[model samples]
Target chain A: MTSGYKDLSITVEFRGGAELLFEKKKNELNLPGDEEWTLRRLLFWIRDNLLKDRPELFLLGDTVRPGILVLVNDEDWELLGQGEYKLKPRDTVLFISTLHGG
Target chain B: MCSVNDAEFETDDELMQPDEVPQTEGAICKKCNENNAEVVLRVKDTYCSTCFLAASTHKFRATIGKSKLVRPTDSILIGHSGKAGSTVLLHLIKAGMSEAVHKRLMYKTTVLYVDDGAVLGQTVDQRKSTISAIREQVHGLGFTGYAVSLNESLHSSEPKIYPLDEEAEDLKGDSDVVDLFNAVSSYTSKEELLHKLRQKLLISVARSLGCCKVFTADGATDLAITILSNIALGRGAQLPLDVGFVDSRELDIKILRPMRDFTRKELIYYLNFHKLETIQTPGLTTKKEPYTSIQKLTEKFVTELNTEFSGTVSAIFRTGEKLSIGNLEASNLIETCALCRAQLDTVFTNTSSLQATEFSKLISAEGPKGNIGKAAFELKKFPCVIDAAENVPLRDSKNCDNCSCSKGKEKFEMSAKNFEKYLCYGCRLIFKDLDKQHSIPDFLQNSVRQRISLDDMREEIADFLL
Candidate 1:
């Protein structure tokens, strides 16, 4: 799988009011893997295509906002290389916002 | 390196880099060491779903169990906001109560959702829909649920409570809550007012429900932010009770934070593990910028700091845990604030901040004759002068019975100046921000009036024997 570039399918989900910025809770996308895709590249792609409004609420600089937690396949992205982790086929990425009031 | 100064200066750049990520491909659970790990917490700790759920449940139970505060028969009203923290709390409670045989919790649980959509500028239909969603989630757990409007705080009578499954009549175009928020000057004060009102309403509903304790799902990060924001808001004296596990401010009913040990990240993980969905509820600063209010700014600061340094929130929470008001002998005997029900912090020594602030206000005020010299002199003797001036009006009213001033003898009207004297230092600031003093809830005004009469009665009998 790591030898050559190919198309990759992934699911992205948002929760805890983070969906407000995306206008939807979940997305299924086909990323054209012309080159090795990293989470860093996917974030910018999503910002360009999927994010509806208030892009600042979702992204800060080159990574997701500070208060937002990014999980890859239900595992904290911190355990995997946060933004540098290479995307694999059928990976599930979840963004949960901890900024909302209890 | 010929000499220390001549050598090129070298620094270890790797030391400043972020912590290394542990490989998760085939990792075993840190707890059980058998099952494949699926969840990562606190940067590096990994756990499987079963182990993670078990640990979380144990933490929740241990938090309440170690306190030994709840009796087997005591009723607890869960203050559900339809958010993640409370949703996880409710799930934990259900799991504990459904345990086999002797392990089951015997205490009864009821849920309450105080709808503050009015303050958030939601229409009647939006508010109703939100209530309906809450009702479904709450009733799905097989617990009794009640919904009440926040505007009920403006009524003189008890607030009307509606069963979750039943429909509640739309409040008749009464814009009291909206008007109250509009009258507030700044978003900071408006948020403060909303918090105080919600707390007051919660206590009243808990009392009516005969629940001895109220459960709130304030996580560690939330409490840390509260600690900092409350201190900034001049509520330093009440910090212990406000962030502590048990808040006994009401004297009769105590509020408990069972999920105080969990962080927002942990709460979300637990929910995701159980496949339990949480409803998104908008708050006062939901869509507003983080700098809009002190509370929001503090929350943003703490959450960001925690992201950079994971121990930031726990350190602040540990510092808050060290605070205690238990040694104050006068805490029970002292008068409380009229608004927040906190012990009054108005009494100060002669050389204190309160006196200094009053002195500053006096000197800074526009003088009666625009003379600073005369103003200072008048302020020094102003207490006796004001008392004499007040007594003259009473004496004249007593003699001139035919005048409209005599009406003051029958009833007492709490003026903003007099009402502020009954509040604590922090509440006084909020009262000052209010456009009208009469806009305060009727229960607070009634309490102040009752206290005033009691003080008057004591003064009348000062010379009695003993």
Candidate 2:
């Protein structure tokens, strides 16, 4: 299989106003499955494919913005090895924004 | 929504991985020995989900219980934003009032939602819809709900109607709302105005509702961000009243923050654990650039520091709590601020201390790149006098009421007579860039008029009083 061929399918959800960046609260994306897909790689994928207007609100430099919280498969991403946790097929990744005004 | 073709952000570092996972294997729940700990909190307490929730609720109750700021007889108005932190607070309060809990807080509760949607230039319909939705949510929680637009403070003298008329362009008048919209000139000033206006509106609403106490929902992380931001904005003098849990700035209507002990992570966990629903409230920068304002920048900074440094927020908050108001000037001065009502500092005092201060200012003016250097040199030629001896004519004195400065041209002599004076130092900073004096809110103008009348009476009866 070619390394660029889409393989891994996952669910992505945004809440707590993080959806303001994604244009929608939830989406299903097919990640390139030819190699190991890390959370860091997924961010690059999301920024390139998913994020819409004002991407700075969602991603600062390489990772999600400071106030945006990332969770993977119902566990705090911090517990699952943050952005390094290798993504598995059908995994659910969530981003919640704490930056929005309360 | 724009297409992905227009993606503006390019990932700068694609090689970065998730941070190295620390050694958390051996840790177990300190509270409940049966379950393994999932979350480690500040003060180094590890807890299971159930234990963590219990501990959080305990802390919330304890914080309020210890501070005798709120009494059973006092009508309490909670300033809720319907977000995660506030959702957790409201849920906890509801649970506390339930018959299942001990020592139920039977005090009458009211939720005041100051719809700041207008700050983002949301249209009248959009803002009204948001307010109505919030009202429904507030009522659903079984609390007395009162809603107001943030722009109402500008025309506080009148009863403001929400969902403003179609012809009513921008808060119904040439109020400071327009100024705030145009005054996006500086991030610091815009944030300052928003905060001050919100506080002013909250206080007014609380008073009108006959509520004795107002509960703000500033969490530990939020307070930490606010502390640093206040310092950066030169509001160090008001730190105690600004960030303290019990802000007794207004003696009659005290503001308290019971959630000051909880962090954002804890609050989010609490909300998720309880399955409580929260409404998304768009803030000033909901659509604008994130780093445009000091408030936004501070939020970004604090959150980033929090990710790498776990206990940084609590440490900052504890330090802020230790700040004392003892060194501050008297809290209850007669000539208080007309805007936010804090005690005004005396600008033109006739004491020896003022003279010593003047001498030091003169020396500082000659220092390299001194802010007052040009002003001092220019005042020498004009009728203006700098460092004049005692008892100069009022017109010749260079004291400007706009600022507490003894250097600027006397504002009364200038054409800027309409600019409000008697504002506290912090409020003056807020008005620094707001040069459109006519747009100054009626709340401030009315207060100024009241103070003027009071001063007139005092001046007329001065000879007989002594």
Candidate 3:
């Protein structure tokens, strides 16, 4: 079985070109799996969604995680208990990258 | 569904001039026009430039004019996307006010731009190139633009304060821009650094220079949120109408979105049809910050709803507006936060678009006077808010020692550490579905590249329309 939290796991991946889709996070950061967002899908979604760029999310081994600091659905999971936070179906997540400008 | 009449047919291959044709992947996507829709050679998920224009303009006008209550003197903040959104914002600004009236409204128009300094892969040089371009845009439009922030700039500044990211580049380019940049980079205390930034950005410049109300081209998706905000906040969020040219009250800014009625897809089409060249986004589009689980979940949820439903998609936002189509928009003016009279009376205002089922629930919900209620009362202040006054402390490039980093601008840098053991795309492919994966299907590996057929075009249109 793919690595997942207690009861939730959705597969996703990363693509790398054009923008800096790749970032080096510290070891032992609070995340599971290593793959980032998939290539074609990530590019397509970026084109499709018209999102503003920011250090939106973290791709720890091709999987998605909550390290990206902006809150979706107006809930700061840090306030909602961080990485252990459970997601109800239908919550919207936005990805703004963190590697915006130094 | 209503039955349609006999549709006209056009066999002419050249219905539109080269200028009229919209290019997206460098293909002839216009063969599916209503006049020529029956024939083959149409593309998928694409629109002929003209059709896209009609749909967006109709949507923008209908939605912005839904209440037709927008007055002339209203000061609006334009969050430009440098694309069709900015075009529409400019067009609407041009259309709504005349030269004489525009002079009156010049101070009323403030453009907010959030350039993410170097993080967006925009080198300081690229960022420098942009100011001139943006200056040209302001000059062309004859309006003032307030640089909001290096969007992701805060919390990431003052490298000397923190050990600099070893990978950070320090090759400073020439231009007074570097000096301003370094001046801001010189601060030691994060709190003080942040305050100095606020002086130039968030609270001081744009929002303070108020008109009557604040407006944005928040187009459809965000428009949906603006409407929802009202439904959630009600008259408690009722912004003041008489905004003098300079007021420090952040909430005093009333935001109106003219293009919230139009979708991005529709807006793009409208801009292309009218021959508007947007600020070009060169390079590949990629996400730097990967999405979190909540973000993915929320996106899927919103997409499913948008795809499945036709109307009422933005219902939560404009519920009352939808319910009272022809009715004058009504905002219940609650006098005070029943709990916090010590604070300014906060409104628990509702929008005109509250759905009937939960309509009464949101507007009249009362809180007990107990401690729990008091805590809940305090919670009301927490919500989606953007400080219209955002700032950036520009300092001179370290290359130019003549700049002022000592005045609060901290020297920033990021050296690439070898911890870059992030996942590559190959590893990610294992988790995704065959369809969702970015790779091409085996079946299409040997397909010939040719003009698309008609049936395929219709399906694409119908699906996008849905």
Clashing pairs in 2: A84-B18
- Taken over the whole model, the C-alpha lDDT of each candidate is 0.81, 0.70, 0.35
B1-466 per-residue lDDT for model 2 (tens digits): 7575534445655433434446554366788788866665552456778898899889999999999767876788888878877778788888889988889888788787777776766777876666666666666666656666677877646435332122223443333575555754675787788888888888878888788898888899889999998887766667888899887778789989999998887887787667666788667666666567777778878888776666678889999999975433543335567676665542444443434544565767668766665655554332223223221343333345433342443232322232334676566667766655335566665565456445545656778975
User: Which runs of model 2 end up more than 4 angstroms from their true locations?
Assistant: A1-7, A53-56, A60-62, A100-102, B1-21, B25-28, B36-46, B156-176, B287-291, B327-333, B346-420
True-structure lDDT of candidate 2: 0.70
lDDT of 3 by residue, B385-414 (tens): 211111111112221364323332123221
Worst 10-residue lDDT window, candidate 2 chain B: B382-391
Task: Write candidate 1's Cα lDDT for B1-466 as tens digits.
Answer: 5555523445666234544555665567899999878777776788988999999998988899889998878999889888889989998888888867347787888889988888888888888888888888887766778888888766656777788888867655448888888888777888888888888888888888898999999999889999999999988889988899999898899999999999888998898888888878667787788888999999989987777677789999999999886444554457889888988876655566766777678777766556777766666555456556654444343333533343544455555666676888888887777787336666777777666656555656768938
Which structure among the candidates has the greatest lDDT? 1
Q: TM-score of every model? A: 0.88, 0.79, 0.37
Candidate 1 vs candidate 3: which has greater TM-score?
1
| Complex DockQ per candidate | 0.52, 0.39, 0.02
Ranking by TM-score: 1, 2, 3
Residue B352 in model 3: lDDT: 28
**Interface RMSD, every prediction, one decimal place:** 2.6, 2.8, 18.1
When superposed on Cα atoms, how far off is each prediction in RMSD?
A: 4.8, 9.6, 25.1
